[model samples]
Target chain A: MNKKIGKHTVRLESKPRIISVTSVVGPKEGEGNLKDYFDIILRDDLNGKESFEKAESDMMYTAVLESIKKARLTEEQIDFLLAGDLLNQLTSSSFAARGMNIPFLGLYGACSTMTESLGVAAMIMDGGFANYVVAATSSHFAAAERQFRYPLEFGNQRPPTAQWTVTGAGAMVLGKEGNYPYITHVTIGKVKDYGINDPNNMGAAMAPAAVSTIYQHFNDTKRTPNYYDLIVTGDLGKYGKEITEKLLKEYGYNIRENYIDCGEEIFDCETQGTNAGGSGCGCSAVVYTGYIYKNMLSGKFKRVLLISTGALLSTTSSLQGESIPGIAHAVSIEYGKIGEKK
Target chain B: MNKKIGKHTVRLESKPRIISVTSVVGPKEGEGNLKDYFDIILRDDLNGKESFEKAESDMMYTAVLESIKKARLTEEQIDFLLAGDLLNQLTSSSFAARGMNIPFLGLYGACSTMTESLGVAAMIMDGGFANYVVAATSSHFAAAERQFRYPLEFGNQRPPTAQWTVTGAGAMVLGKEGNYPYITHVTIGKVKDYGINDPNNMGAAMAPAAVSTIYQHFNDTKRTPNYYDLIVTGDLGKYGKEITEKLLKEYGYNIRENYIDCGEEIFDCETQGTNAGGSGCGCSAVVYTGYIYKNMLSGKFKRVLLISTGALLSTTSSLQGESIPGIAHAVSIEYGKIGEKK
Candidate 1:
């Protein structure tokens, strides 16, 4: 039998200890809409240099604030801020954080930032760095399109495998000795070139990296597919997920029984038709923080392994004919006791 | 007696446990000029959209790669990527990593990203999550200028207290049982408002958060200012440093003797003439990875405390006339040997 050493402390039972997800926030409705490169329509009221800047910043801030609220933490009580966004100078995150001024550490891992940030945050708390830590990320279609593709109103058509950039943010707060399942293990992906030369086909490029990291994660911890209630990848589209499954099978692991890809799962709308699926920092973020966290809170699943995969390539390098490489990081987040007051 | 365990390990006789930084990489000798945002000089060679996108992506990739090289780690060996950047979709980091194909976790902390990433990475190694981890961040001038200040060609003048946006990247690698330092304690800053209302004066506004975190760090660790070689804050500029000093004195700790603020110290160049100093996410990153890390490797500093501060205000709130609040997170990095290498 398990025992409580203190108010929030948990003494492990005969079963292995599990980390829990206490709260999650972001995404107001079903799989958010994806804005095309030139499809972002901003009102004149929100126009100008500072306008869009603030919008992006505000989105990130709200995500984190909402998550903290769900966790019942004030800015003062939160131990750390782990946040990032898809902006050139990280203006949204930096600026959003400007007023909430709390102890913070910024990070960037592209589309996989949320899980990366959460992984590290959990480790810190588990290692006794602090009690509460928050992780957040944001992505705006206007800002991202302007940087990576055609600006708004440019009328560009995306490729078949191209993913809809998510214009949103997501956040979660983690604490040590909480009733939530503790973060168990993390797996870091390695940069690998499998000769997929197209930067646009990021899904295909990143699939293998995802497989390798996930495989290694299981290997390192001696865990099997049955160990987790759910296994999810960050934002690998349908194609990537398909290939990832095949690759995992090659390593003698079958994940289809309990696997879900955040990208494919979150943007599972017909008219929404997010090509391969939602692909952005916010894709996995919103899915996990909003949808997944809500489910966990309701006891839909108890143990989960979130592997956020990312394609780490640049347009310049793609233009330079460099083959795209990919990486992914895996973190285990679980739910603990049910209906606990915040 | 002292003995060498292997190429990866070092031991000392009854010496205090210390964590040392081995190397760093980023914009050590240059600055990004926001004024050039509208020059359109590179327009002929590349479209505006593509140019900015490439700039954002390249900067992110450059910082991570360079930091890894500086740390002398190969792409295959790194346990994980702990990174964050400001972008709408986290495109730069995702795209960059897609090409590198390294296992990674994306993170965000606005401008405080690097330190946050590092803090988590360090803790993971300390907690036996992984042996090696990398933390990185990047920012670009043109893209940021357009997003945060003005359109590319607006040519708006920045305030004197405003810091120059860094158009570069920074990266660092942490390893357990390496010759470098073991990250000790970490203190997360809280959002506190002394009611500084000016957006232009972010340096001053964020100073209090920095002071609070640093003071708390010393208190938690029960260490005095004279305990180590240096105490560094991530991006507090000249103005912020002065304020931090005053606040520290009130707490009865004198850090002025060995205190170093990354923003002020890094952009202290006469030519740079950065009024207060660097404020972008890359500021503290480049300083820590480049200047501080090199100094530590050369034995110039034995122990250091790196406090990365951030103002958690969105551009919208600032435009809405909301007061800016700030927070800070600190990681104690010490050099030398601790116990035995695994």
Candidate 2:
């Protein structure tokens, strides 16, 4: 009856299935490498809304509704909506939930929200609390910039280590019964601070926590790098990816062959002038829901270890000279495997 | 097997028990009506810390440690720590979690986070996901004031409707095996917006949400307002409480006699000079954990419904001329009844 597997990992007895997924991106992201993977691409960031904040909420709404529709279920069927975003007070997700009319639980794992919500959703489903749950997250470049950095109109100079915040939203429907990829395990993370205080270089700041969770996941599940066809990290950009790889090697695990950072994979940093790469709640969200989920459905990858890393630092905290505390949650998904019925 | 009852309520089959509770507050809250109920009261807001933010984190850390110690459980025995605060990025909770080293999930529902975390903790415990879970939330007046309004040194004039943010933290330990008040039901709320744009009048902004969740809880459980010994709202203050009562009366259910708002109960507005009342994540948290939990344990009250209301608005959102969205989550706790053995 014990679902917990070792220190921080959980092995669900009834693995929850991902029934449907949807991704929406702004024009800049749409023009990126995974353009074909996105469901809807807005021509502009505002999407005809008066403000970027409203546009972000609309993107989340569209993603949630589209995901539900794809799952062949009505809004009434969803037992809970678990969501969060980078905006203060989770404005985007909360506003989007107002129109959905579902029971809601607002979470804040920063950019790791996608995996955090997915882990909680699977736990609730496996625990027999709900038959269906929707997990979603969103981010807007302008919205995040004004809150976390400078205002959009500030035109502040970006450092080479600074990463671009992706303007997008992603939603996934998890249910008790489905023929989709099954969420087998979840490793909740501990808040780890390495004293990296640079807000612009979030990749370096979050890398340590990503390595911590990755090592814990492998230790708890007793699975080596080969156990997963793809080991993906959420938004650790090029700089953080290198740090993670180096740290993992020191921990006696080499994930060099299979590991890839979602931020680095989302855009061609050289040609796009994105500095380090992409970073935000939507960075890994769109990548996972769009590219990874589709690939799993096509049987291109059988097993995946998806770890979304988040740098938990606010503009106020950074200004106060506090170091960034990072967290990374790992969710193991396997394709072509059906979990036992409740 | 379906734990969900009606539209938004879930009836916990196992009925997770609250093992222990702890509350730590600032001098202002310690001088309030429920002064004697708090476990620890600081002499000042900063608690010897250089910054109010660090002081809030310290309070949270103390509360979490005290709650775990009171439960007679080691840190390793605790499966998860679910927590949040009013600070941007949940810095207080995240910093507190770092010291505890427990698997952490940072939640944000504005001031409603106490009930939000508690509900999720109970569900996880009842669903057999974990034997022990800790739910905690904190808020600091100085921290919230500078972030949401004027800086502490600004000496700005306050509005009559503005409620003082409580500087405190409260934590509760929930376990599968405990002879304490059992969580019977939880009603998750939907975000409701009625175009109330003023952040100072949060009570007016959040009242409808409190009404919505309370109504749904009564409807789902098929119970009247008088079914319980008491019904308390999180931080609706005087204005929101009146609005909620009027709204409930229009729905053909009157809760005037049995209802009390934690904000209203915490500080006497006339004597304490808290314009509307005390309002923050810690308002309901300390009140519930310190006074209500103790009373329930002594059998002073058999059944109670605690609804925590929150105005989910950020400084940026308000500056952008957006209306505040409100949310409220209700948790029904009952004593003198033993649940099934683990």
Clashes in each model (backbone N, CA, C under 3 Å)? 93, 0
TM-score of 1: 0.69
**Candidate 1 C-alpha lDDT tens digits along A12-56:** 221222222222222322324322211122333133435555676
Looking at model 2 chain B, which ten-residue stretch has the lowest summed lDDT? B333-342
**Model 2: per-residue lDDT, tens digit, B1-342?**
578888888888888889999999999899999998999999999999988999999999999999999999999899899999998889999888878779899999999999999999988887677888999999999999988998889998778888999999999999876578989999999889999998989999999999999999999999999988899999988888899999999998899999999999888789888988999999999999988999988888888999999999988788778899999999999898564331
Tell me the tens digit of each residue's lDDT in model 1 across B219-290: 766678988798988777878889999988998999989998777765554577566777766667766766
- Candidate 1 has a DockQ of 0.23
Docking tier of model 2: it is high
Number of the predicted model whose DockQ against the real structure is largest: 2
Model 2 has an lDDT value of: 0.91
